[model samples]
Target: MSEQEFTKSLTYAPGLPKDATFYSGHKKRVTSHAVSEAAENALKERGVAVEDIAEIVFDLQTPFMAGLTMEACVENVRGALAKRELQHAILVGIELDKLAEKKMLSEPLQSLVDQDEGLFGVDETIALGAVSSFGSIAATTFGYLDKVKPKIIGRLDQEKHGKVNTFLDDIVCSIAADASSRLAHRVRDQEERRLPKKR
Candidate 1:
């Protein structure tokens, strides 16, 4: 892709605090919502709608492979996991038929792409954050999950990243899943506070 094309692929998250800081290695904040929002904004800018995206799956059951296509990306990710010999898989779907059919989730996953929705749920947020941290692995994983189901299920293996310990992984997930929700609230709150009617 050209520079413009690449630039168009980036998405920016709204409402980043002016004093907010970014981590260096990304392992800590990889799962954060800010990263996810930025990535989604980038892809949308590139014309890839969040709704159009299939899934965001993470497989640490294998080693990471280089030069992967969308299909290969999953395998490569699995390879990355295998390399670490991690024994778990996490998948988050952005849009899935089953979720829409069961109506288990508050809104169809598509609502995530709707900026007007003002942040509703964690489905898209988590997936977006994981993708931001892990790149296409998260997106394709989500795509794969969407093809199968909507529930963000995975093989629980907390022991894998024990050496690099921190609740940051959990934090990242929370941030991604709820960042937009918080953003919408913050924006609305800011606006509300500024309103003469309320004052």
Candidate 2:
């Protein structure tokens, strides 16, 4: 077969002109709600409650966001976790940490993950990927949280408990950062809406 025909014969993602025939079906796709629930459960299983993450969000946003209640901070956390990309990051990052905890990963990777080496930046990379979607505010907030390691996040980073939280800490940073960004936008939108009423 010609090179073009050979390329067309391959069945991969997107599938171009062959998508209608190649990728069409009643495929079993996960629901957004289901993914959100799974992400929440994963956090809970790792002893990192959504409420704990919300506290971080509250800390990050409460100053700039007037009248932002803890309840609203928690709601924003759920909103951030509902995102599919963020959920994927949570699942993958947590799985890596879990593997390190159990020593399932091999050799240097296991050691690096367990120790959470200063130079091992993969954890931050995964987290930034999730937060970057929320814009620069969320991305910068993630960096700040990563640096500060406040509250529950700081506890997770402590190794005395024998829990490997290399990725979970950063994952928490991403969630809190994204939620704070969401809350910031929400508050700004509410203010903008009120302006019309005032006028």
Best by lDDT: 2
Q: Estimate each model's TM-score.
A: 0.21, 0.85
Model 2 residue 55 lDDT score: 90
Cα lDDT tens digits for candidate 1, 63-88: 33233234433333333322111111
lDDT tens digits, residues 118-191, model 2?
99999999999999889999988988999899999999888556689999999999999999999999898988
Whole-model Cα lDDT of every candidate shown, in order: 0.32, 0.86
Cα misplacement distance, residue 126 of candidate 2 (Å): 0.4
Given candidate 1, what's the lDDT at residue 103? Answer: 46
RMSD of each: 21.3, 4.7
Worst lDDT 10-window in candidate 1: 82-91
RMSD of 1: 21.3
Q: Cα deviation in Å at residue 76, candidate 1?
A: 12
Q: What is the Å distance of residue 113 in model 1 from its true position? A: 17
